[model samples]
Target chain A: MPNSTDTPSNDTPSNDTGSFNPTARSRVKRLHERGKYDEASVFAILDAAFIAHIGYVIDGQPFVTPTAYWRQGQTLYWHGSAASRMLRFQEAGVPACVTVTHLDGLVMARSGFHHSINYRSVMAFGMAKLVADPQEEAAQLDLFVDRLYPGRRATLRPNEPQELKGTTVIAMEIEEASAKTRSGHPKDDEADYALDCWAGVIPIHQVVGRPIADPLLKAGVAFPKGLAGYRDGARFDELLTTNMV
Target chain B: MPNSTDTPSNDTPSNDTGSFNPTARSRVKRLHERGKYDEASVFAILDAAFIAHIGYVIDGQPFVTPTAYWRQGQTLYWHGSAASRMLRFQEAGVPACVTVTHLDGLVMARSGFHHSINYRSVMAFGMAKLVADPQEEAAQLDLFVDRLYPGRRATLRPNEPQELKGTTVIAMEIEEASAKTRSGHPKDDEADYALDCWAGVIPIHQVVGRPIADPLLKAGVAFPKGLAGYRDGARFDELLTTNMV
Candidate 1:
């Protein structure tokens, strides 16, 4: 584990700024006050969900692929088919950017110019390379499953031989990172607050729908307790954070 | 307007494949069957939301920035502060990829190997250029508002003089693009269906919460009908699609 993120802070002034030193790439140039470099702040954004938009370059053309992602300590992990062309290009230790965003609400300012969205986002820059070892790769897969589902891995059938060979896991230790967030009501001009207009937030949320059982499942098979966190109407990110071990 | 996206197709096999020809850069090599090449397929995915992850490279490093986005005919648009570093970097007609994804559901299979998430996503590759013309830039900003909120543009206060110069809008014509989508239940191995496991799809939907009135709003200010589509329980993407012109 990297000492920067893993070590407990002393609550000093330096820790407030964070242990992850901002670089030219990770720095927030516009509205710099919103930038957060603390490990706790960055990890909270990453742990809230398992989806990420990975940015990478093949030749000079950039491609952004949205994929499932998880973080353990300071290392970020994502997997895809071993035969995947994108994975092949990334396994060569490519420089990559992984970004996660959560849309909170829409801020309706009195004027069209002040309209904005409330959100929390993190952008982590790192070098991505393959987890080539079979034993290590298998463990990472288990983490991906158990991380979201808690104890679900123990109840499921084991991976088949072909399944083992077909999956490719990529690991990237975050070298530079930054988190940006905006929340609460719109910050309109002081005078505009008195305008005769409907100005407020229409909050946005990702909620859980009912869990559907497969048609072919055994009649007696109960809904797995491991995934009990997915109950209907629950907040999606909160459930993930609640289940995060 | 480009005939490929605008002209009605005759339901021929080629038209079903899409009017947008797949190139080496935009082709979906893995799961080729899931790849969509036609203009309608690509535009549907793009119009479903106002957010996109833009992939652009600086020097040899890649950066993915999530920003509000809108589509008009063959072109796509997004805006940010004029002083924004990412916007400045992209204003020079830089090669970029704009990706939009909607998480639809979580598919739980009998085995961990078959577990997957259902999603609809589009990747459009193009050269991003600044909308330098003040007249065109102003209209695009209005379109951005009225696009999501319908006629909300007319009810609001006019833009300030500084707001015009403070915002930078970027436009990218869809040069090469592809849409990949997966839906429904888990397609597990046929034999695994007999396993004593609860395998099904837990549907995921982005829903709207209650609209919050600004604390400072006047008592008589009514909720705009243009934004009535944002009522609670409406699916966010569907609402955006409904409001889309």
Candidate 2:
């Protein structure tokens, strides 16, 4: 494991520290100040996001790939094509920046200028290494599957040898990171409140619609209980985490 | 105005490109067979997203801010605090990368290794300039307002002088860009079709829910008729453009 060094003060003072918040590492940014940084605050934002924008450089060319990711302790795991340019360059040890963001709502404040979105985002910088251990890769894969749909790993058949050989998983430990967020109502000046402009948040959320069964789902193999989060009218992320996790 | 350099090619390649797709423009990457670049393809993805990740370097520290954006022709405009560090450093003529992405659905194939999400994303590299002209800035603000709530511009009070002073609108002309997308069912190997694993797309989408009016709205000043799209639960970006433009 690589050690993280905290920059005393840098160009972006917001992210000079490595940790977001310790006490509430999982939900730090979600429930804290927008721009403030602590160990717990940053880690929470990073763990909750389902997808990430992975940035890396190859042949002096930079590429950002959107991929599914899961965080375990301080390390992040992602899998992709064994031959992808992004995977190749990333495994070679070039520094990479991974970002994940969640949009909460649209804040339509009284002043058009003060309008902003309520969001939580995390940015992390580190070098990724290919997951070379067979046992660790299998366990990480289990966690990755459970993150998206809990309890499915034990229900599904085991991976075959050829299947395992074809996939490539990479791991990256968090080196430097920061979490930034904005939430709640519009903070307009008191004087501007009487300007007759609408000022409030247009709450935004992700809700899962009715789930459609597979066209070829085997008869009598009803939808499993753990997969109920995909049903219609479910509140996407919330249902997945609350009911499944 | 920056001059446009047009690249011409004869042999139409179905894939991304083969050294002929305007490689001189630094932002455009030539993935050769692995690339997918088309005008409508890129625009559709860009137009579908309301939030973009703006990445820029200040004093060697990189910062990525999530901001609301509007695209007019080849120009992308976003507004923020005039004194904000993001705006100040962005105006220093540093090269910036803006990325917009929409995750469509989850693709689960026969093999667990092939699981991926169908997504569309675009990344553009350009220099952002402050919208210094009063008339131009006003027009852009109006465009932004119109974007969020179509005819609301005519119904609501106009921007005050102090409000304008507090706001900073930045516009970036597209220099070079690339769009990539993945869609359809999982691409499982022919032999895996008989593996008894579920194989199909779990279609994901962004659907708008009921609109909640501000609690303090004047009794008579109800949601305007021009804002009908906001009620239909259309895709966020489509509703934004139709209502504003």
Candidate 3:
């Protein structure tokens, strides 16, 4: 087995006491060097991705559901039909773990055993409760739309009363959260570096294509200004970072 | 509340006895229509994505960890350091739920309530066990490299005995699996269609950029033929479909 010296120490200093406290549930046990327990790191990963896989238990069985999520400060918000089982269980104050991951690149090493993927991920644990107030729900809905595409909320039709009633919004104050990120090139074995093999990284990017107009759109309707620079081949990372609020 | 008629019946026929039997745990309860139990559908979603969020219950708390996964016939394979807590628990035959999701596009609806995402996902449930046999573990490792990049195993340096010993490979025979997919344009309310708003889709794709060669002493190395066609701006869906093994 390779000695501890072979492993990379990539840990950076924790910001301060103001950063998120590392609870037993939120702590990273494996490869502890990759863990970050700061609000900045956790929120950054959460804000960059719109979808998350929420894990919750019912009847002692674990279920993971992928849904759209948005973060405001330390609170994470998600919604679905009021009758959703996953939402109901979460709203009832059960423990929920929300995870978001972005695959940055494929790390191809000289040996199969050393191959890995570069990724950014966050795991947040908390008890979610229903946003029962209609006014608050409506505001959060607007925020969600605006977060996805800024200023489009003002142009779109407002949510009807019945529409809001049918939807169930849930909010979880991130009680404990941790972010893990891996970047850069593959760290192959020292001796393997001398072997004749192409060892490098293949960058994986999520791109947003051009907006395709609806066939039912009225005549002379132009694309909204909010989506101007988000053209057919815009880099997802650049768009997200530039639009980060 | 959406009545039975308001909800779209997207369910297709479940193949006969040969198809994967959906147990109570694997069934999609919220939107029953979107559930699919056929092997073709489940395998398609599993094969497309290289990463998965594995959910498991530890002391009644759910934890979801995102890791690289590969499927071979009925068995799913994933590896990590032998010291990984998640792998150790899974190797002991604990219940595990592996979920893979691909966000296809953002459904821009006329109203915020109707806004949804087009996605394809698969949730597979099984009991995992460690691959302890050295010979079998070596073969699975090779399969994983080839699965990610075709014919990559032939070009890479062989794994050393120590490397295999340091890694832990786990396999799970999928006992229950289900696939869920949502596609096409937004289904807005009839009255909202008349309103003046650009209602359509913003296609989101995960693309592969040009391979960055490692800055080492290896000069005059040509680009591998296997990775030649995977250009920076290639569409993700087209590439995934064309390269489906």
DockQ for all models, in order? 0.74, 0.21, 0.70
**Chain A of candidate 1: what's the TM-score?**
0.91
Which residue ranges in model 2 land beyond 4 Å of their true spot?
Answer: A1-33, A57-63, A155-157, A160-166, A214-221, A243-245, B1-35, B58-62, B216-219, B241-245
For residues B206-237, what per-residue lDDT tens digits would candidate 1 score against the true structure?
A: 88888898878878998886677888888898
Worst 10 residues of 3 chain A by lDDT: A1-10
lDDT of each: 0.83, 0.63, 0.79
The regions of model 1 sitting more than 4 angstroms off are A1-18, B1-18, B243-245
lDDT score for candidate 3 against the true structure: 0.79
Q: What fraction of native interface contacts is shared by candidate 1?
A: 0.90
TM-score (chain A only) for the predictions, listed in order: 0.91, 0.81, 0.92
The lDDT leader among the candidates is: 1
lDDT of 3 by residue, B69-139 (tens): 88888999999888788888887887888999988888787877777777889999888889989899889
Model 3: CAPRI class: medium
At residue A103, candidate 1 shows an lDDT of 88
By summed lDDT, which 10 consecutive residues of candidate 2 chain A come out lowest?
A: A1-10
Q: Write the per-residue lDDT of candidate 3 for residues A115-222, one digit (tens) a residue.
A: 777788999999888988889988998898888888888887777787787788999899999888777677766888787788777888888888877677667777
Docking class of 2: incorrect
